[model samples]
Target: MLKRIATALWGKFESTAELKKFGFLAAIFGFIIGTYWTLRPMKDSIFNAIVGMDYLPWAKMLSLVVIFPLVIAYSKLIDKYPRHKVFYILISIYACASLLFCVAFLNATLGLVNTVQSPWRLIGWAWYVFVESFGSLIVALFWAFTTDTTKPDSAKRGFPIIVLFGQVGNILGPLLLNARRLGFANSAPVVAICAGLMVFSGLLFCKIT
Candidate 1:
């Protein structure tokens, strides 16, 4: 019975090994994409709250300015090192940055730092820049890894299923946020959760074969 459902949903594989591999890769890809999607709304909301909708154009432009050079550097790194190593470096940096922001924002919420002041606004701007840049790069790397790892045949069958998982993540992220409105109210915990998802997805990425 379950086999029928599995086959109906994911299609049949020639062997158990193929089935397992397809599921594994699909899961990793889905989580990676989902994690990024989750951050999308959070970042947008925080940017709107901190700087107002009027300033979003300027923030996006600034994000492009910051991301362009980093993208070039990342492309060069891909040429110089193994892709997995590059993934590790990038994800680690993102995770650490998230943790730092989590701490900073938490302090601000607790009155350890003044959030209604100049430096706080500056920090919010920086967060907006990082979020925009990271969103583009992470999604690009995920698809790149997907193409690199998936056989053409498997990808044709499996990519859609993987994307479905990502869609679930996309739906789930916002629902989770809505449920945790208190976290979203401040932005710090939201950033922390996004960071944790990135780290978790990175671990899963490492395990992909």
Candidate 2:
């Protein structure tokens, strides 16, 4: 029976409420992973378009420098605030920053329209670091929140479900935002969509937690 198969696969739940909690948690994980995957290719393409691929190593080096401060700030926030509050704070910051970048991409001077590849093009470097730091911080924070909240027995069942959804998002996110469909001319549309997903994920986190 389908019930037997699902029980075997996902383990038995004590209550319907518990099952629903895991389902929502799984969705939150999926959204975060999906947004990260979607942004990865966009980061490279936009950076290449605006700054040239030759400078990629420099941009990555910049990301390393930027991430340390970000992680430190994140740790301070975690220490100062409740975990859910920290999640909201960080998610709001990222969602707003993403939207700002989406709008920035529309500007002729700051965006892909500025085809000149100079080291002085700071937007490209900033964007590369933004996405890179986002990947590291957001994913780590989510897992930290998950482990803090989940009981060990529930996590055995729930973590697998969450990972499964995250993997699904990982596969689908980039596939949906492929270059052929969105084209390389403007990244605004893709960035806008990613921002929306980030916002939705934050909302989901609020609801679930």
Candidate 3:
């Protein structure tokens, strides 16, 4: 039964010209939530541990000013490359990118630093920045790739289905993220598994796009 559900969940988007666009716009919302929701229950614990209550709002301010804008700018930067140049490399790059995001998430959750004043503490927060920033970037790039793959008319249909798959991931990811507080020592491994799932999703997006 699990195999059957898995098989059904992890399949290519069928090439129906009419259905491709369905997933396009939905992909954005799907992925935004997917990244956000992936670490849901433990978000506060992780944030407080790394950035601390004193620092989180400031960090969020920094992210809004720097990380968030860069993410948008990077998405628009897609236009800089010759359109045809976005090929197999996007997948490999995104996979590597996803791995980094996961590592960042794990490091933040572990608070693997001496103290808030330690240089290592900055590194953990930096990882947190990267995880949140790049995770959104990954989703944006995924849709951009899909738009490039589908015909202008057909994309409207397929996009929704694409988002649907990601939405499933978003909803399910939080459900699975419940292991965060078991022990600090084990946090990285669990986050790594979550990251692996993210990368696998990236691979699927690459395959279908």
Candidate 4:
């Protein structure tokens, strides 16, 4: 199956050199997610502060609890999907996850999730944690896909560059998050747009891979 995907995609590449370039392109684009993700914590703070200080810690706890389940599910998911397909799927998930997160957070901001001393506040906390888990899961999946996609030789020569791209992605996440902090449009809308980008990338991942 991998060979077939390589064949279909490589038809556009006349030589090994082009394959290397394609790999680099994929690495760069894939890693760009890092940039926006790294800055997430600060955004969470702004969101929570705006939402309610009382709500933040419980949300974090809920998010942590959800990670165990998400990680378990993703470990199983990785076993079943190919590297390229996983990347495609993850990118789409990441985009959607980001959008949902924006929605959850923004809703919190506008008092949509506000409980006003109600028990539902706990549920709101869980919802915050639940949304964060998806973003976390998508990142973990994409890193696995990156490592799997690189060949032995590429690992030697390209891993460094790819790793750097990942670092850049890490930087980008915070930057984008901060940008949202600077009174940009709603986080939900921005992340929703990213979901569309992920879907587009998934299509390319499916066709070429």
Cα lDDT, all candidates? 0.71, 0.85, 0.52, 0.56
Structural RMSD, model 4: 7.0
Question: Residues 130-180, candidate 3, lDDT per residue (tens digit)?
Answer: 555655555556556656667755554345456676777677666655554
Off by over 4 Å in 4: 1-32, 35-39, 101-127, 130-135, 176-186, 200-208
- Candidate closest to the true structure, highest TM-score: 2
lDDT of 3 at 181: 45
TM-score of each: 0.85, 0.93, 0.62, 0.63
Higher TM-score: candidate 2 or 3?
2
Q: Model 2 over residues 38-151: C-alpha lDDT tens digits?
A: 999888888998888999998988899889999999999999998888888888888888888988888989877778887788888889998998899989999998999889
TM-score of 1: 0.85
- TM-score sort, best first: 2, 1, 4, 3
lDDT winner, 2 or 4:
2
Q: Each candidate: how many clashes?
A: 0, 0, 21, 10
Give the TM-score (vs. native) of candidate 4. 0.63
lDDT of 4 by residue, 1-209 (tens): 53346547434334566455555545545544653464355345444544466767766776787788877877777788776666666666666665665676567534344434443544345445644764576556555665666566655554555556667766765565443565754444555555565566566455435
Candidate number that wins on TM-score, 2 or 4: 2
The worst-scoring run of ten residues by lDDT in candidate 4 lies at: 110-119
